[model samples]
Target: MDHFLTFSLLSLLLSFAAAGDFSDDQLIRQVVPEEEQSVNLLNADHHFSLFKAKFGKSYSDEKEHDYRFSVFKANLLRAKRNQLLDPSAEHGVTQFSDLTPTEFKQRYLGLKTPAFLESAQKAPILPTNNLPEDFDWRDKGAVTGVKNQGSCGSCWSFSTTGALEGAHFLATGELISLSEQQLVDCDHECDQDGVCDAGCNGGLMNTAFQYTVKAGGLQLEKDYPYTGRDGKCQFDKNKIAASVANYSVVSVDEDQIAANLVKNGPLAVGINAAWMQTYVKGVSCPYICSKNRLDHGVLLVGYGAAGYAPIRFKEKPYWIIKNSWGESWGEDGYYKICRGQTHDICGVDSMVSTVAAFQSTSE
Candidate 1:
């Protein structure tokens, strides 16, 4: 009986090892459409090796997971479908394409649950009007170069700084990149419970704006810089470049959001980024992505129906969003989410905050 049990175990191990073989050329060809399959076997092997190394994948018996790279192949196939479906739609393979969905979300989506309040203080409501068919803050020189947050979940700070930078530009005729690191290290109470912009864990843009007002002002990126990690607050009052007089919570109305985008320069917004994690390009909407529930913060610089290259087959209305994940992602560090209609797109109009910045302000 003991001999039989040992043999059974050995046979099971052998079966698993055989099933884990992702090296079979036929298997690769079966998963990836023949037309899309790489003609060079060596190139395919290189990508597979690099992917395995990057994710620290091992085929050891102790590793109780799909060592066959099934998830990785599925995602690549999904990306291909996304591209083919829209043709002009958004999506492509990047460093993230090789990662399993679970790994991708774990490494990137760090926003905490329980939504933060829109704003602690409220201002008078603003009247709304029809905004132009298209507009971009970058065209007006009110926007700064794209930024990357690295592995840190400091997107709230980046979003806040982008809004303040654009506001300051429109107010002082000067475009300046503010310090996200300052907020990461210093934004007080905001670090509490990770409810709103909690260091690298996550935090709210509204909470961040409030912290900026209390901190007197924020330093320029050139002065404080971003380390993408939590550290001691190195804020220097003298190095303060811009001050937020106050911030307003725009109404949930899409028309108001449009008006605010044109009048206020850029607005910081939160969205449900589940689909955006693997998003390559195209007009993102409720059909293809989740609606309501915002887990990521970004800046809305403009909105229009005109799409960008490769995905510009037709005019589909979308929000011109600026991300801090470097220029390598999306359309040069920018993404176009679907726009228009009454309901909010990914809850973008849900938690919008625009700060009023000035070079000089009285405490």
Candidate 2:
């Protein structure tokens, strides 16, 4: 009887995968009713009591998902953290939030930012010089789609691979889109359930680079297509290619960033996009937005320093950023961060990763 029940569950899961009915987010929605309910309630509720009730239930469900994702993110973050935390480690995490956003802007944007820039300067800046040159940075292209990692919190893999795809083009002049599926399928530094957990929470680009180099490289999308979920590791020897470079970080002011763009190309920067800041629209004014906390990461590609109003945001300059979420998002796969704002809300002065050659030129 027990065996029959196990077989029945397996059959159901297989059927769902075969029919493409189960997506990561969808699976969470199905298993965790509170997520859907919270969104629904948010759209519906007006009174406090109702909101509280709905929020409580949502929180309950979110905890379960968060726990699951935490485990996955932990795996990746832990390794990267260990590397960053190691006293002997060559690289260390830099915190650049101490400088008011205005100071960062004035130094980098060559313009005075809104008063809010003062507060944003306190955010942390990691040590990384991963930004590339303007011509080198490609548009997000046709692959800006966002994928859900399912019960797994392997956002580290998605984020790492996403940046690598861009970095590969900038470095090798190869516009080939590599595979995230390869990392998901092969990386065994963590669990094998296909759900990346604490063993795989958040990862750095370095790990991905190491994996590619050691394993030879990854295949094109067509060769190792994403199943939207993890499966048995199927290594296709023919899919191998050249390896990528080991990434490094560099911190710069907003002015330095613009100067770098004029001299080099694009760069990757980390920003704090807390839960509330998830809404990307209606952010015309910096402080006006409800959420002031940051928690997300993005890449800065170019700066609009053309006319009399060379900068964006009234008194501050703006830098163009490429995001992972396909072209459907943020000013067509791009958005502008008010450089040198009062508090670095947009990460005006942050860490970026680019090729060593590009770094030498920028310096």
Candidate 3:
């Protein structure tokens, strides 16, 4: 039994090490959740009650309530470990405090393995030497308000539309909320490996981009709206508020990703949302996140370096991400991750894609 446990841990460590960021997993990875910590342990019962009342979480019976309470307690411990591993960020009970990790991943995460395209266009290399010290699409009136994905695994659709929304805004100088429901109900394209852009099951951002191109673009949120569930396709070709003229995949380099974000628009990227389940706020920079196993799709809004410490090299650079979980989570429906200040933390920098141009649409 001890040998099996050791082997399992070694395999997990090797998975994390494959990204070529760290040689010693023990130095940053928190394998044991109950390890001694410098911070105060949270009052589980008190927090659990508060979580229930805040989220309006009511179970059918006492048995289910007890089960959920136990899950919430376990999540508190997990949050402590996350807090320790990501000391730069705040971690605690969230709306999903009652859910187990599997439940959370099932309902929230929705990114599948990116499909290799036969003719996928690569984003042209842009100059990054004169990039600004801080950049955010929200500040430029390019990004729309944060929306919710509910209990559906349709985050990829939201991420796909988000990049297009920004691209459309940059092209037409109009910020219009696009539709995720359009993609959720419509896009069912499959790759050679059988990986598809499933509605609520899971999907990839690049695949959704491909679908958007073939479908003649997407409608506005007010025109199509989002239901957060699978439904019949009610697409209207005449109501395409944002149409993709062309799209391209950015390189894995961090500076280039930022350059694309600044020059083009918000870039759609994938991320490992394991730590995000209990994330409260601040900047999340975990030391032991899987870079290759990205499960959730989000938008790369901007990048900045400041707060919590000296603004210079003393702290790792942080990227601002726009999540689809509504304004109740993280920094007003956004997440910040510092990949040891790298571009590939949680695989955010790996599968980056953006709409290079949008078909001209006049007001």
Per-model lDDT: 0.70, 0.39, 0.80
TM-score of 3: 0.88
Task: State the lDDT at 193 in candidate 2.
Answer: 29
Candidate 3 at 188: error in angstroms? 0.7
User: Candidate 2: lDDT over CA atoms?
Assistant: 0.39
TM-score of each: 0.75, 0.47, 0.88
Per residue, candidate 2 scores C-alpha lDDT tens digits across 19-60 of 654432232223322322232224222332342343332335
lDDT of 3 by residue, 1-363 (tens): 144544554566567667456522242344442343333436667777788888888899999989998888777767766765566788888888888888998999988985345567899999989999888889999988999999999999988888988988888888888899998999997765778988999887777888877887888889888888999999988887778888888888888888899999999888888789989987776656768678899999998866362212256678999999989888889898884355577777888887855754534
Q: After superposition, how far is residue 111 of candidate 3 from its true place, in Å?
A: 0.2
Please tell me which model should have the higher TM-score, number 1 or number 2. Answer: 1
- What lDDT is reached at residue 80 by model 1? 55
Full-model lDDT, candidate 3 = 0.80
* lDDT tens per residue, model 1, 16-43: 4467553222232333345653233335
User: How do all the candidates rank in terms of lDDT, highest first?
Assistant: 3, 1, 2
The regions of model 3 sitting more than 4 angstroms off are: 1-30, 33-42, 115-118, 309-313, 359-363
TM-score: model 2 vs. ground truth: 0.47
lDDT of 3 at 84: 55
